[model samples]
Target chain A: MTAQALALPRAPRVDVRSVAFWVMIAASAYGLWTLKQNSVPTMLAFPPSAALNVAVLLSCLAVGVWLARRVMRPVQAPPWNGTWLALMWGGLAACGIAILMNTRLLSVWSQSLGLEAASDWSAALTAPLNEEVAKLAGVVLLAAVSTRLVRSAADGLAYGALVGFGFQITENFTYGLNGIVMAGGVEPFTATFQTLWIRIVLTGIGSHWAMSAVAGAGIGYLVSASGRSAARRVWVAIGCLLLAMGMHFLFDSPFLGGLAGTLAKPLINFVVVMAVYFVVRRAFRARWTAVSAEEAAAGTLTEDEERSLSRRRSRRLHLRAFPAGPEREAQARVQRLQLALVEERVPALAPAEAVQPWRDAVAEARAAR
Target chain B: MDDFKGNAVHGARRVWVPLVVAGVLLALTAVEGLLAKALPASEPVPAGTVIEFGSTGQVSAQVGEGWTLDRTASDLHSGLLLTRGDVSVRLTSVEFSAGKPDNAQEMWDGMERLLGVARHSGTEVWLGEPTEFDTKWITGGLYGSLQVDTAIGTAFVLPADDDAEAVEAQVLGPFDADQADWTAATEIIDSVAFDEDDDTGETA
Candidate 1:
């Protein structure tokens, strides 16, 4: 190991599960209290049917989970536990925090500042700042559970996206319900459906997930990124957090005034998404390079193996080059071996014994071929 | 040495990434500003003739020639009610004693039912639906439309020009009214304008 690698800080072995469990319980209690205090009366009147809200939430959950899995597939990240954590603590807990901020903190701060709740400044200034911070808390909570889970910028992004997915889906459901109430207490289904289409189908990608993922990359760099100098890590962290906030600000701002209702909305969404894509792609590639370099140093990876594993599509292509019968088995062996390599590398992950069988399977497949 | 090089490159990237992101955002904002400027300030009110309303004449409607102003039924703030043949365009703002309702259309519906406006002599025929209406100078994208008594006697209720506890309405006369009168009323509503520069100078 390089002196720099040995000098890198290790996170304390905290009991992440217990901490996460307590956080969830607190979030649930707070959520129930808020619901009783604010939502119950309106819900009784049935502006939008409860069933429709549940359907939207569940459907979004299913799609979000599926998307999280797909994104991790390319990276060969172990995602089930992290994905579950994101859905429960990130989704449900983060949502509770957001509601508390919106209902209580925002209102109190606005009043103190002598700003009316409906004022333009309140939305332009207070909303984006508070909401982004609240949502970022979800990523922080995820990291707290297990720093190893987010040991690189790429891992941070995937987990962050999942956290964002949870928050977005929950917030979308509320927005759908609110739209029903706004459209004059008639045809709840129509109003809610319209809201769902706009929040979910149209602006979903440009919304919470994209912004939070950028912030998560920053958190990832701070906690992980062993090679980076401390000052560089701080700069990256600050830059990413600010970028996330700025994206939210630009989206929420009425700078274009009435003209924004036209072609400007989609244009702005495209710009923000592209900016996030740039950061994400760079960070992801950097982490991959670091991992590959480590493998190279270990002398366990052949030149052919290294080339094949470099890209997801290329890796698949390399596996597929063998004949169909044993070729498929060999492909599976390669996948298992790669997964095992990742597990073996991470100290907090499964031990070397767990990966031995997968290595054996790869050797058997190579011999058969 | 490779690790050192990789770290140096990443460090450099970290410094430059924010600049790139900021530049992109600034460029997009500039484009938005330019596009907004290029678009016309507002579409001109359609009809050649205009009737000014409100104390400061902040609100105005472009009316067709044949319609006569109903001064007794009108005021500066409520707007000038116009009548031609049996058709009447009662330009009025419905103010709510309570703060703004969660849904303005539902509130209007309740008011109509309570006032028995649609149930004259117990013969009832009224239906409402979500619809779109545009005033030339001040366009509300979508609003509520209620057809009362006849196909032609419709009341379009929308969010007020600038008030939350109030709604703006343009009611047309029964279907029996002359075709020309109906056309004129619709035209006038479509061409309603608001001039924010002339704030009604009223102190609370």
Candidate 2:
């Protein structure tokens, strides 16, 4: 076997088009799990307002996904090397360390100055800036060690998102435990749950990941644009870092009304994001098509893949081809698995292979179409 | 092409971690829901009965097992006139008056003595004639009323008489024509008698 084959022995052969679909599902699932394990207990405390809390959480998640899609370009070819994992874990650790250090320092300073000790804004301001910078540092480290990990803006976003997810889970756990204490038993659990819903889920607003990804995107952009001067790259990184801080400030600032006001701001942000998305879509409309063509020409897409893509054009054909039959179901599942592989680019396929029956069913449906 | 190869590799690792994490979170949420459902209901506090203190000299009322004697500004002004559950009461309009006094000193001494005795007994007392004078005797006119109505009667210790004869009889002697025509008043006094000897001494 060739060295490339040896290096990527278990790597599945598929077009990059399928990869994005899988990565999104995996990321979404992880996000959902983290949200449930860390936030549900706190939400239960708000028994009376549990439904409202759940709604808020769902809305926030939707906003996060929408923002991710709009601001970050989709990575057609994902680099699944351990570099992404290291960046994710390292980013989380760095954020934790940064928070500890910044909080201690701020506490001492605020005390000496006769200011209120760090509670909401102080932590918000300090954490978003310091922790985001730290997480961005992981992206930088990954980019330095391996040029492949952050070949696109979307790659940076994915890594940053993972890091943010890690940070969010740890933070939510603390918030949940605090809620339990405040509730003082089951009677006030509803109130506790509501508090957690507002603080952890709704107010999250993707501040950490968005800010870190902004920095990561800058680094990726710098690395990709060849022959760029080091000074120019530094300037670009600094600009991105500043922009991230500004966004963090807007997110954390109390300028917005209290809980209701804060909640409203995210919606406003979403609207603004959507508008920007349309603009971006207009600009990149041709670019995506060109990229798709290039990918297809490079032998990345098989004849079956082309047929499957065509089948999705009509809803009737789409449904009929991707029918509920075990064979079609298996093909669909394989398609999903292959798509995930293409998106995440992770080499381990045992988990992916486990879902082959579903993939095969999906693929057969495509062939029928 | 090399970049594409790199991206393909990176994309694969991203899928599984999030999926596993999401599954765990869903399970946690379900557990939380179950725990919440299992929690017992909270105990409620019962509402207590209302206890009214009409005049408020010294209110010695039974609350549960204890007798509470509350010394507040007599319900005449802004004192505790009632106790209902967790709430207290205060009468807004009320006034008191003495029919006769030998002299100003006697009147002042009597008012002070009555107030002191009431205070000692844990009952609040106020001194002032039920007249059309908008002045407070205690706080140098900071607070008082001249109105003598049913609401005022409820606050004062004096008896109420609606009969013309009875009210006229009550405002005799010391309250006669020499001092003032009590009959000119719209509301007649129940009784306003002064001792002859006391009046004589005052005149002398």
Candidate 3:
């Protein structure tokens, strides 16, 4: 394994011609349609409660997507379209798949084990197996859609979180609708509001987003073009997925029954994600610094440029010394190209021509400076 | 740059990934659904017999003869669904984390929404107003009737055990169904009790 080989695909680029891209669209559309069939009528039936749930959930979705993008990656977040695509896959494709699979599987358990036993065990046994795979599949597809979308574990974590966030909000909205039934429908609006808050406040911390992010990191390992051994990558991927599923099972399981227990489940999941984030961030930073050092050795980047390139604010600070207008713009372009070159660089063993495009692009920018 | 075309290709296109993922997912769902369909999820429910269920065994209700309990659809935590040849009856109870509704009328309002008549599109149906009625063992229960083009039935909301706030039951069947069907439905509704210990509405 040449420790994770590859050039970063151009940022924010989707290989639209890829089979994966089309497959994602088709599956997501089908899922979205199925969900609408059940939800739309309920919305129309009780317009007020539905509207309230919609307003609240949509607000949460906006905040979640924004926050996930800002925090999931180390140096910078994954590009916008990829992040949106991951969320789309989560909300539409994964949720749809879970609905179909869980309904069937839960019935099987109920019939086979009888409702008495199935009640305690069915959800605990089912959702982790079904929903985690469904959500992780989205991350895998994004990688398949384009190498640029998820070049590292950091990329996978970010995209995975987005996907999970999408699934979480969609699930929350569904729960709000279901909440009416649970609360006996006496106070429809109140029931909806109560359900949304409990979910958003309590479980939302660790739920689908955290679990999928873990599983997605594993996919990052599996798909990484780096030097990690094939067996190692596969094992890490499997382990991460199982870990995610375990976390989910605990969340849905009957062991912890009350309010404190409810809070504990998500807290546990949040801690696990934070651990993975730190490790992935560290690895990404290490690789980044190593690449910059190599570029400096080759006289492609000056010491000051190398020091400031990886961080946005630092880059801005470095560029501040230059006068305004054309000079600043030229220097900014050179720095941008330099960072791109570092991101797209392959290992030393690869043929020299492999990095020629990015290197040439950087040189042109430098000349503009 | 040709081999490295499309924004600098790094990895071999794993085009087969999505196909395999989707195929496996569909395949699993199909297998599970088919297997569940092949096996029955119900047992015969006899008349004038007590049925004990729910998350714990505390919740109990009497059942009428000639119905099958759909264990798969029914849950110990929430309620039960039973079916006969053409008639289906469901006895559901929810213990609200918040207290019960303020009044039977509010509960009736809940039952109306629960019937979800408005959710079914392209249907012409009439739902009658609920009237307060006294049951054999329980008093002041509310009942309403609904007809969806052909099938007709009544829905009930009754005071439950102290632990549980209330219980709701609905019986739906064809119009020509015999009085025995109605007798069985009534038998179950009259004796619907949330807790076996309380036995507030125990019948002979």
Candidate 2 TM-score, true structure as reference: 0.42
Which parts of model 2 have CA positions greater than 4 angstroms off? A1-92, A111-121, A181-188, A225-236, A268-288, A294-369, B1-204
Q: Write the per-residue lDDT of candidate 2 for residues B1-204, one digit (tens) a residue.
A: 223333222443434433443344345335434543443211111222122222222111112211121222222112222222222223221112212322223323322333333344444444444332111111111112221221121112221221000000111112112222222211111111111112111110
Q: What TM value does model 3 have? A: 0.91
Superior candidate under lDDT, 2 versus 3: 3
The reply for model 3, stretches above 4 Å from the true place, is A1-12, A346-352, B1-13, B46-49, B52-58, B96-100, B116-120, B123-125, B161-164, B198-204
Assess every candidate by TM-score. 0.58, 0.42, 0.91
Ranking by lDDT: 3, 1, 2
Q: Which candidate model has the greater DockQ, 1 or 2? A: 1
Tens-digit per-residue lDDT, A161-240, candidate 3 = 99999999899988888888776767778878888889998789999999999999888877776767879988998999
After the best TM-score superposition of candidate 2, give how far the Cα of residue A262 lies from its true spot, in angstroms.
1.8
Model 1 off-target regions past 4 Å? A1-18, A32-44, A47-49, A72-74, A112-118, A259-270, A290-299, A321-331, A340-369, B1-204
Question: In candidate 3, what are the lDDT values of residues B88-109, reduced to their tens digit?
Answer: 7887776554446767777777
Residue A359 alpha-carbon offset, candidate 2, angstroms: 24
Query: RMSD (Cα, Å) of candidate 1?
Result: 15.0
Chain B TM-score for each model? 0.54, 0.19, 0.80
